[model samples]
Target: MSTLDALQAALAEEHATLWTYGVLGARTSQSASPALYDAVTAAYRRHRARRDQLRLLVRDAGGEPVAAAVAYELDGALVRPPQVQRAAVGLEAAGVETLLALVARSSGEVRDWALTEATWSAVWQLELGGAAQTWPGAPELD
Candidate 1:
């Protein structure tokens, strides 16, 4: 795939992740679930920043960035803190896949940026209670 294509795919995943995080954040209570709320909020902010950066990257590459869907379907119920954490982990895991693709299709600064993003996703997954993986984005290795 072309770098632009990979970037767009990554952008799309970011969009979905941001949407899911937003929902997760809304369901969480600051006083009742401080840790989960903070985690979700942090992930949401990170993804939002990445989404904006991706838009700039796409535009600089002379391609239009893909728009986020009106809403994203949650992986499962997010009523409780554990459920929210699980969902956040799932989203980061999925995002790692796209970031890996971005790294593969890009080079130089873009590839470096993608590598950083993928590493952060893996760490974020662990923060959300996921097991650490030798190859975070490659589920086949897990």
Candidate 2:
């Protein structure tokens, strides 16, 4: 795929991730889990920043960015701590996939940026109770 396509995919993932984190934050807040709440809040901010970056990248490449969906279909209700953690893991894993695709199709500064985002997603996946994979982003290789 082209760089613009990869960037659009990443932006779509960011949009979904932002929505997932919103649900996570709400559930964590309701559970009174201060630590989880903080983590979710931080993740939400990171995804938002990444989303904005992806939009800029698309625009710089002379392409219009894709708009976010009105709503995303989550796996299930994230009403408890364990569920919230699981949702986080899934979100981060999905992010890793998206960023890895972006990295493969991008170059120079864009590739570097995608790599950084993928690394962050991998770290977040581990933090959210995912096992450390031999290849964090390229799970198909593993």
Candidate 3:
């Protein structure tokens, strides 16, 4: 896909991710545990920053950014803290894969910046769980 088109797709993934995090955060209960709750909150904040960046970038590209829905269709019924982290980890893994695909077509600064984002965010994710591959598209074309 074209860089702008790729960016739009990435933005859409971010929209879903942002929405998922919101529900996941709110759903975290007293039983969800403090550690998982804190981690989930931090994850959402990071994702939100990236999501907003893409939103503005969409404006630069003369396209409207996708609106994040109030909620996403989650895979299963809500569970406890450990399960919440598992869900959060899965979401980030999927998002990393999508972002990796989007960044594949970009070059120079955009490519480097995209890789940096993916790498760092993946690192954040790994902090909560284990190491997971973010970039199936690497060694990136750009």
Estimate TM-scores for all models: 0.96, 0.94, 0.83
lDDT of 1 by residue, 1-142 (tens): 8999999999999988888888999999999999888889999999999999898888877899999899877776889988888888989999998999999999998899889989999899988889888888897985
Question: Which residue pairs collide in model 1, if any?
Answer: none
TM-score for predicted model 1 compared with the true structure: 0.96
Off by over 4 Å in 3: 30-32, 131-142
Residue 96, candidate 1: alpha-carbon lDDT = 90
Runs off by more than 4 Å, candidate 1: none
- List ranges where model 2 is wrong by over 4 Å: none
Writing each residue's lDDT as its tens digit, candidate 3 over 34-130 gives 7778888888998889888888877777887777666679878666666677788777767767677767877766677677777766776777775
Backbone clash pairs in model 1 (N, Cα, C under 3 Å; residues 3+ apart or in different chains), count: 0
Clashing pairs in 2: none
lDDT of each: 0.89, 0.88, 0.75
